[model samples]
Target: MRLSLNKDSYEDVNLYFQDEARFGMMNHLGSYLTASGVKPIVTYQHVFKTTYLYGSYSPINGDSFVWEINGVDNKIFEAYLGAFSNYKPKEYKIVVIDNAGFHSTKHIKVPKNIYLLRIPPYNPELNPCEQVWQYIKNRFKNQRFKTMQDLKKWLHEMINEMKAETIKSITGNHHYVNSFITTFKI
Candidate 1:
């Protein structure tokens, strides 16, 4: 659903696109620079342990909120919504999200100040948040982590060091996002 906001209502409206990504001990392998005719061997692990990162990004102002969650479920999603609701209590948040089962409103309590707008099923490209995940995963390619904690620490550091300008450069250039920002002057 789309948010119907009057011009005056724009002052308190904050638009965000949200998504989650999985990080694990399993590594993503990619090509590395090597001498001519030489194949580079990359170390990898097969451990299945993983964690989920739920993130929301505001394309207009490069604001964001994130939680490193252990699992994906209605309860966990509800908690994330609650935390997001509390993050900016003064503004009304319109979050664009996917049609994940855990995101079903029937099973979770949506905060009063937050509204969820589900993108069409099978159309992940419409959400700019997908770009953020791609940008993060690209950095993970060809890297190995000895433990889950180490992986999580590295991921945390990467995100923490990310500047708002970097996030905007990655996710704010989409036409869909720009249109919304322009329409509401957000």
Candidate 2:
């Protein structure tokens, strides 16, 4: 009856990638020029500029949907909920989310089919959908995209490439999900 709708943002920012090389030469005297010491790097024109992307993840079926938004507001939140409804079309879907302003706004119109359940304040780790962001961010870590479109394309590709079983393995190990399954037998 209740499906946990997790809402979060993923941003694309250019930053220096971590040191990937493992092997480095250490001179006996002091230090010498080494191949590993000079690592290849990718530089971008702007580092502070970021592209904001919002999404909702469904832990029940290992499904995720994303959108590029200029700002986060109650209207957009309602629009996303509508999109979620169109995507899944469940009769009584309960979404568990954090206390974000967009999610809890008075102006937002919640669809009759969707019910929202807010988690405790400041507790994001308890949400199983957080795992979805963790997995995606890890996959794109230390990498810089040439453009926002490129980043979006890559994210879409990576998500599409992942199988449902893989998504379940990545995000389905949470206590809440287990409890839901046990109680509902879903």
Candidate 3:
């Protein structure tokens, strides 16, 4: 599962955490790296720099995340790689992936031994990214941010304070998923 900033309402009451907040900051923040695949787009708020998926407003961002990558910092990935660094992955020749436009970067520099792949398009069943976003949206619950800055601050703090738990939630293995998912429906 992935984390996505979405607008929510509690009963008839308007909510503070709006999807627009994340997008607003992203739109204003603009892109950082280029010629890449699945680059982590981060926003620096004073002390912390939390990186999410590449911002995709108009294919402008890129692909989103799946599982723990949603709520995780890049460190998690680094750590995961570090853990498996000693082990060799399966040998493969040609890699195949879905055509997300974002995933179709020939200029991205990757390790020759490693292969990148994507699933088919219009196939949510194959992609966990959609599930991740749905899960993240549910985290807001009845809470509303006072402002976009507030929500951003909350998210930043959330990541910092609850790194492990956040990782679990993002990976779609947390009890919070039920709460996160039901927020929109009810």
TM-scores for the candidates: 0.90, 0.70, 0.35
Candidate 1: where are CA atoms >4 Å away? Answer: 1-11
Report the CA-based lDDT of candidate 2 relative to the real structure.
0.55
Residue-level lDDT of model 3, residues 30-97, one tens digit each, is 33555667675454333232334321110111222211223333344333333322233332111223
Q: How many residue pairs clash in each candidate?
A: 0, 5, 9
In candidate 2, residue 57 scores what lDDT?
Answer: 56
| Model 1: lDDT of residue 65 | 94
The TM-score that candidate 1 achieves is: 0.90
The positional error of residue 159 in candidate 2, measured at the CA in angstroms, is 2.5
RMSD of each: 2.3, 11.4, 18.5
Better of 2 and 3 by lDDT: 2
- Worst lDDT run of 10 residues, candidate 3, spans 11-20
Q: How far does residue 34 in candidate 2 sit from its true spot (Å)?
A: 8.7
Using lDDT as the measure, which candidate wins? 1
| Model 3 misplaced stretches (Cα beyond 4 Å) | 1-98, 111-114, 141-143, 160-186
Using lDDT as the yardstick, the better of models 1 and 2 is: 1
Best-first order by lDDT: 1, 2, 3
Please report, in order, the local distance difference test score of every candidate based on alpha carbons.
0.85, 0.55, 0.34
Candidate 1 lDDT for residue 155: 88
Q: What is the lDDT of residue 20 in candidate 2?
A: 8
